[model samples]
Target chain A: MSETVIKFGILGCAEIARKVGRAIGLAPNATIVAVGSRSAEKAAKYAADNGFPPATRAYGSYDAVLDDPEVDAVYVPLPTSLHAKWAVLAAQKKKHLLLEKPVAVNAAEFDKIVEACVANGVQFMDGTMWMHHPRTAKMKEFVSDERAFGKITAMHTCFTFAADPDFLENDIRVKPDLDGLGALGDAGWYCIRSILWANDYELPKTVTALRGPVLNKAGVILSCGASLYWEEGKVATFHCSFVSHLTMDITAVGTKGTLHVHDFVIPFQESEASFSVASESGFDELVTGWVPKPAEHLVNTSLPQEVLMVKEFSSLVGAIKAKGSQPEMKWPIISKKTQLVIDAVKLSIERGFEPVEVVG
Target chain B: MSETVIKFGILGCAEIARKVGRAIGLAPNATIVAVGSRSAEKAAKYAADNGFPPATRAYGSYDAVLDDPEVDAVYVPLPTSLHAKWAVLAAQKKKHLLLEKPVAVNAAEFDKIVEACVANGVQFMDGTMWMHHPRTAKMKEFVSDERAFGKITAMHTCFTFAADPDFLENDIRVKPDLDGLGALGDAGWYCIRSILWANDYELPKTVTALRGPVLNKAGVILSCGASLYWEEGKVATFHCSFVSHLTMDITAVGTKGTLHVHDFVIPFQESEASFSVASESGFDELVTGWVPKPAEHLVNTSLPQEVLMVKEFSSLVGAIKAKGSQPEMKWPIISKKTQLVIDAVKLSIERGFEPVEVVG
Candidate 1:
């Protein structure tokens, strides 16, 4: 068998794509041989600077990138509003997909994309790098198997950052159609994804939301709160805000114990993350003078998103080549479940918190 | 004219009445002149045993106790379901009233009671004991006036306790018609009351609630969660449970710092409370550090609720004895607002959190 590398083409010169493109370029068995943009000159320039040969493709249109026979996979970093259209077009070309977070603006649109991918027999994976991380799998195993946190009673997740306009022009985050789901889609999805994955992808039985309007900006949500009925008796609440302080924290409370992660999504680059679990009896006895255990460095070393993402993608490509097919693993399952949850949250927001049922 | 102690009468031998009876017996310048119950023997026995002479009167029915000219005031500790009827009757007799907490089941009922009190030209007060405590007034002044906590943004209050069926048997708290408001009417009212009082009587612009049933217990709310919305994007979430492990705590987050009080509502009784404020740049620091404030110890000091009750009631009596035709400067304005907020919370619960427009 020939040791074949996955040839990759990326559409949209999005901020995220720049990092993902670099990742693909560095992947051991992957090559970003093509780049597309709205401007032909810009596309050609990007391809040239990024080591694409003159014979390699440089297209001014999105469809032109998908039309290239040498491109086995397409990385779609387009705005959320454009995610479904591009993913469908790429699937029509029978190319594997790595769509950006949220996958689509809403669940219905995401479903159509999923249907198209399945119909074309193409591999579809939503770009949720965190879920693909080894640490995430460890978290899931601890919560679900080890039962380190007992029967989950409540989970609180927060993701927030100050949005400075000048740096984010035409950013989908401020687009009503693309980002109307607001912080929930932008950052809250991670919390939702984390909770769902930890709970074996048990969809919320009921959901309610509270939304605040963005000030000093049009078509942006300032903050949002969501409550999820995860099971017959367990409930979870999540909050995200663009106008508040920066934070990414997830805490889970259960029958006999509690677990907390201070920074789950974007952990401090130099600071290791500390996790602590205390049982009911342990919590009581240790209250007087409880010394928290030293933090464990989950990542071998700090790396930029582009480097880490490329590392993971290269690993996946290698595994697929070795297996002669997709690795029978959790990534596909995690991505599908995460996108479905993202869609449900958008629906709940639109209906002013009317419960939305999630189905497979 | 000789200064004379005001005589007080109480109808019903409910546990609340027993508490009030002791208060009346020990309150300075007040007398537990008479007692009444459904049974004449029980009424006579209670009156005699509690130091009320036969000359002070004992009656089989509530009206008999009301008609005793020696009883200058009446304490109505009847079930909230029975509050309206007995309060109206007490008002008709021109007797000043000490109505138990949750003055009425709903706003309309509370309005009716207020109207009846006005028509009879008698003083009426809700027995929400917490608000009358000096510490409550001090705390409110610190939070809102001094801004001790600084721009309070969020408040989390939890009140949970195991119910004693022996004490609650046939109690209005367990009676559907009387305590139908559930936790919003019972202990939950205190949570809302505290927030409203602390926030200068600002009514919640929006609210969300989750209620769980108390198994096999009639008219009792086993657990409830309510999130309150305030102007300028502030929020307060409160939880009350009858089935959870006993816990009570209130935490307030503000721009300048945070304040936490454990066992809040009855901190004066069951626990000690401390407040800590962090100094932040560009904000005036008013309160800082964990200062151990004195806890109100009336409940266990054997000083009797009557002593404090009479002290407060005597102020109204003194105002009455003055040249003014009606008692003035007796009832704290905060009490009126607290009642209104309690009514709004009930309306929110019944109407499924529809925004209740509150009159200033």
Candidate 2:
């Protein structure tokens, strides 16, 4: 019956951890209880630099943070290669897990993490922040409206960022021993998530990587794309790269309407985001111009999407910890589906751009 | 030399011809001198309903319009099946040709039309009106700016319209013996043209149709998509459909910039059009949102794009008529390249979604 505040432990000093740390500070039900790094001095510096509260603990290793009794949840911002190891450990420690994506290098590894969470009765969620944005719900409303959006026919999503020379050469994402999956695991994670999100979380029947994928000498993808086909004629394609300009776009066309968002992965503004939609649009009598032009809809939120994500995860964790409620299954299910598609795309690429059946 | 007005004779009273007739009237140096249909009554009715000038002649047959001495140029709005026959005949009659696109059923037929125009020393331009939009030139300026846009990387275009039940069953676009190519020739033409336009009219090395193209029982494409690959790592994908909501979008990304236009085929407004451009876009600290957000650039025009197309065509025709200037080859060249890609996509679809080498 008492008010519960979820205590979150930071499980690495990765760059993304700084953002998640800020998000923890912003979430009303969440508090940063601990910070950890391989070196105690680095952990202390990260806590100080990210503005951890005075009472927050700094640990010399991820094991120390997971071993903290007061840490109700752990946000794992470690690289993709470390996700399975740390995520399973945190779940075994009975801490609700907020893991970063690509949740693992492949769905098989991710299933182990999911199993650990289920066995421990701990909540699990991936760090796909945009899924928590208010604008996403609003856009989903439009796409689900039968009279407005009708049945979706096709969708295309692209997420690309031009990495600086230093990042391209030395970033963890490009290193096989670190992130391992490279751009496909990083940027393509978001792209596949988006395609699945647009299709109401329905997994496609097959995924075929497009030809001309650029891979580094270490067998890490630098740029790639894939087309996913579903039964009933629904199709989706996505492109993700670390070598193109920063561009995030989603164009979903349905029988009656279309939804277009230019900045989908990261919004143009922190407080508000906009998407354009047109329903039953047609040209004028002379076909010179559209009769009913598409209209832009804006959704505003007081907190950044990352903060909203932390708040949502913490709330789920709080329910399970304080009231013995069952952990939410939707988040992990979505994460597993996203990983499945990513793995299918990688397999398609490895097989010379052939179609790979997506088995659930 | 006296100023010469290029007099246009419309071959066939197709619905699209009404729009072109209006554009011909709007172009300052162009006049609708004749309109012809299979029946003289239909021709007269089309001219009257479409607001042709009182002095415009109505002919019972297309040959009569071509035979008129005052008709310096002809706008061929006939079906695809008849384009080669009518376009070549108009060229042989010493008339400059403004041909409707899918310029022919395939490149072979289109090339024959081109040869006839060359032999007759006639100006040739396809009725791809968007190419003449003032906004298009503005967009080109952004994409071509080395400092602002950087080198092109990838592009995606979509043009779709949900046909009403009546149109789905009876429209000329879906008829096998009429337009034949259906949505690909109609909507896909714009998508291919936009991709080619973004790439500075450079033809791709190969074209591969995406899987699951929806075809009508009549063997006409109802929906389709294709990916084009250039040897220089530039890639493009486009989708066109008659079973989806009306949406025309182009997203072109470069090394340092991105360009997006939602209504590319037909601007939402006749007087002004806008596109969004993001040059050297990046994220702010903490990576919460975009810094230097994409800017919207608007271009205004007194004439609609179609009228501008007519005016540009007439200017070329007038130059040849009044000053004995040679016909410009750029327009025909671009049209041929677009047709070549379309042919390749069709072939790829026929070959069960294999990559088709695009031989220019």
Candidate 3:
């Protein structure tokens, strides 16, 4: 407990947990103290396979990790259906929470997790790694510049990956009782989060689900899109799917400038990410081509974005434990807004693709 | 009539006409034989300013230009409201029509223009300049490669330009009786056309207007967006506006590949255009970044796309005039499909953003 490093315990040996486990090790202020799975052998294998330190404990059950007084925080990479249950339990046990996205199946469930965090004075943040990328910050600076970008008019984001047939049928994401929201929860989360980030986290006024959403036999969304409208005429649209090639893009157009990025969910390179921006773009005198073409900006990062996400989350936890500071409210608030939009989109789709008012 | 070159008489001295006039001059098989405006002095000025040949005729009335028996074709850059009238008249005069888009305010009107072209045995093509770009052909080769791209799943296109106050207040595009459809016709035309082009000219089954379209005082849409859905589950969305920074993009995602172009309407340079494509994109072993990032392909062209459009149109006209061949039906068919989608989107907006079935 006297160690300066934030000791982390991950609940469930999900595939994503391995990545986060590495992130915990890479993050300067964090360390993996333990990992838990339903089977002790799976936990041991996951730790051994993912380069967890020899000192890391392999727990037979998630509760064993929660009960470990040495574990300062828990990374919850369990299925969406298990998020509220385990995240709240971890929070009650005084473990700071790093919950995987689609933080919960719905906003109400996320609210329960948030309430637990508040009651137990635990720091909470979702596993939206891209937000911590240095390139994201640089892009935000350009878009927020009044002289350069002016008022935002519209934004569009998309994230899609062609999932293998076996994955589509057997993955927990498609199971109604597991990651019930399917691609909308897994892939759409990034698209929606990017839009909200471009809008400076302002909630949209309404959400309308685009037609022709592909659904699995279990009635889970395989692919879908939605348009979001703000009261001030700023509009955004996003599409996400498990049936298309890997493509992640964010196109935000303001009155004076436009921002374009092809890889927003993950960088094309671990050390660097790039985006293009054009300010006051116009055609040449002859109307043949662009007068001032967009210029690409590359941001270099020493640590991968996921590791940065872990560092940021652990730093907040450190502040709470060391200085008795109140838990950071920003991450949970943003997570709740994203969950709200996701729920609104789902409702709009359920209502025969009608426009659903987004209630903040 | 004995000359091999296609003689083009341009209708009106609009700004776009000057560009097309230069395009006509650039096309090896097309010559600007005449230009007509409401004022003879304006026609003379336009012809002189645009470097038309000394022998080029200047007419005070459009009818005078159409009456010239030597004029084999006419490039109609008049406002949308005048398209059906002038285009049909040009066709009836046995002049091949290179009409500015949105060819007409509606498909029914464009049908009249096409019917006249059919009756008069003259070629018909809308002035969608980018369609003839060599880069477009190259991009098509990649998108159509089944091994590389697989089945088309979704596409999104956007075209927007920040309009000055004068333009918003007084431009012909904002006048209901002039362009009528406003930004939807002026800018959205290219977006819808790009979507149709990506789908290989297959008409969408339905069109749903996205919420939050901005319209001028006269009820002309200044900014708008719509989502088009095909019966086979392919979906496309597009946004066009006169109030955003200049941005023309096409992001087409297939089951196995993705294509991205930033300046699709107009290239960044007159001599070359580039697009990015990724086939079977995957993540690196650690899932940190793309394993093989999208590669950029550049295509060089001696003539700008507008000039290519003129060349293609005149080539069709030349074949008909010299070899006694039938006019190409492909141009009109594609133009009609584009107009049909536009009309459906307009209808959807009028119906309170309901999904309107597109009947081609």
Candidate 4:
């Protein structure tokens, strides 16, 4: 079982890369071989500050990271607008990709990235760390249990952060040319992913943007919401904002069970996570209170969720390299599904809040 | 404070009547004086079965209870369609009214009932028991605190219960000629009230019903949701259904804080209720976990919420009778606000999911 570690080269010294760099240091099957930024000096400082091994290379450009013979994969944390260019180029250079999310500005752009990955046969995974958390698997089990959860009826999720004045004015997320999709893409990406995950990756039929979405002067969404409808009467709604307090939540209700997780995007603590579930809930005899109250389930993790995400991605890359196996399609498939719904929401918002049929 | 007690007269023996009847027994300032139904035999049995005092009268018709000289107030839990006629008649009889939720099918009917109560000098209060809960007041304090909660930006609430097959077909809530507003009127009533309550009863500028609402064969809404938008970019959404697992929740997000209550309509226990709040929350240095996690605040109640509702109503009635005070307008004002939003949602759904301006 002791295989060669998957060597990773970070594409940018973005703030998120600091966390993922620590994850790579913690992941047994992953190691950083190179770090890249627009300036080699900045890349070297990021690697030094983040405690990458002294032997690690600092590249002046992302192309140098992809060109390195020792780099088995690239972690793309570049601004969303540069995603298609670098992700496709990284794939074409025969390197696997672990891309930060809202994988592309739009689904079509993502499709092109996937096309390149398929052409080069490189593994693909988005940097949604919560998906790798052990607690998420436990939650998925509860929501999928027929006896415990029954048919899923509705779900609500939100991811919001109160951006400071500097962030609101100059952050890449609010810039039309950087993270062009804005809050609807950055914060909303997690909300959409959670909804799809709880629904067992089943895509809803339509997405309708709620009215009164706030936008910056550059026409980038600052806060927004959308409701998704499934033909079987299953509905899900999500809200994402850059102008609200830091709040991450997911509530999924089935015919017989309900699941709630307030820290779906980030756990309260690094070592433990918790969620509440109530099955076959009803009122007491006098209807004064619940008969069987919701029970909180705690999951303790040996490693943080981000570490697990890196480990999982490394294992997949190792499989392709050592076993000559096909790259895992599950991750990109889910990423595409999330992107499709986001595209639908964007279209719905553009169309004066009309219901846009989701193209799966 | 030791003035006369308010003697209550019950309407039909609907299932909810049993719960309120228990609350009346618990409230020191409220007493059951009469029980009324279509048949005298059923009324007598209901009174006996509920352990009513031997001195309490059993009336064959609702009119008899309204005319009872000893009955100072009426607890009208009749089907919604019967509310306009019987509630107005009771008000005209100078009987103070404690009406059940969705006080009438629509605001117009509710307005008529209010008019009758005003003309006859009778106190009017809808039986929204949660409003009287001590926990609700405690939660309100948190949401209202400018330092703790900040300006409210978004809110979401839901009330859903899985109805048995028989209830789906025969329950008064689903019957077109009876409690006809179905889930939107029954479960959704609580959702609307909670949203309005959190926002300090500031009506939303518009209400747009979500698509894919489930309806019964008789055109009664069985499942529905809507998004309410305020002009200042604040928004709220709610979902109600008769076919999902029982879940009552309220999540209010402000610029600096978030409030979450899992059991808003009914507490998990009679003596204790809890809610979670997080103020100025953010991630830790590594972004692996929350810095200041959400803190759970438990509020203990000496009496259940429904008992408090009865006590509050009876105390208001006592002030009117003993001090010749005018009726308190707060309860009716909130009820009217909730009903107005519901009417707007209904209208939006009728207009093919268009945004309906809420006329406060």
TM-scores, all candidates, are 0.61, 0.99, 0.99, 0.99
lDDT of 1 by residue, A182-224 (tens): 6667777787887786567777776666433233255455566
Model 1's CAPRI class? incorrect
TM-score winner, 1 or 4: 4
Q: Which candidate gets the maximum lDDT versus the true structure?
A: 4
The residue pairs in collision within model 2 are: none
Better of 1 and 3 by lDDT: 3
Ten contiguous residues minimizing lDDT sum, candidate 2 chain A: A1-10
Q: For each prediction, how big is the interface RMSD?
A: 9.8, 1.0, 1.0, 0.8
Indicate which candidate wins on DockQ: 4
- Docking quality band of candidate 3, CAPRI definitions: high
Summarize candidate 4's per-residue lDDT along B238-273 as a digit string, tens digits: 999999999999999999999999999988888999
lDDT (10s digit) by residue, model 2, range B1-360:
445778999998888998999999988889998998999899999899999999889999999999999899999989899999999999999999999998999999999999999999999999999999999999999999989889988889999999998988999899999999999999999999999998999889889888878888899999999888896457888889999999999999999999999999899989999999999989999998888899999899999999999999999998898789999999999999999999999999999888899888
Q: What shift in Å separates residue B229 of candidate 1 from its native position after superposition? A: 3.2
lDDT for B355 in candidate 4 is 96
Two-chain DockQ for each candidate model: 0.05, 0.78, 0.82, 0.84
Q: In every candidate, what fraction of the native interface contacts is reproduced?
A: 0.01, 0.71, 0.80, 0.79
Deviation of model 2 at A337, angstroms: 0.5
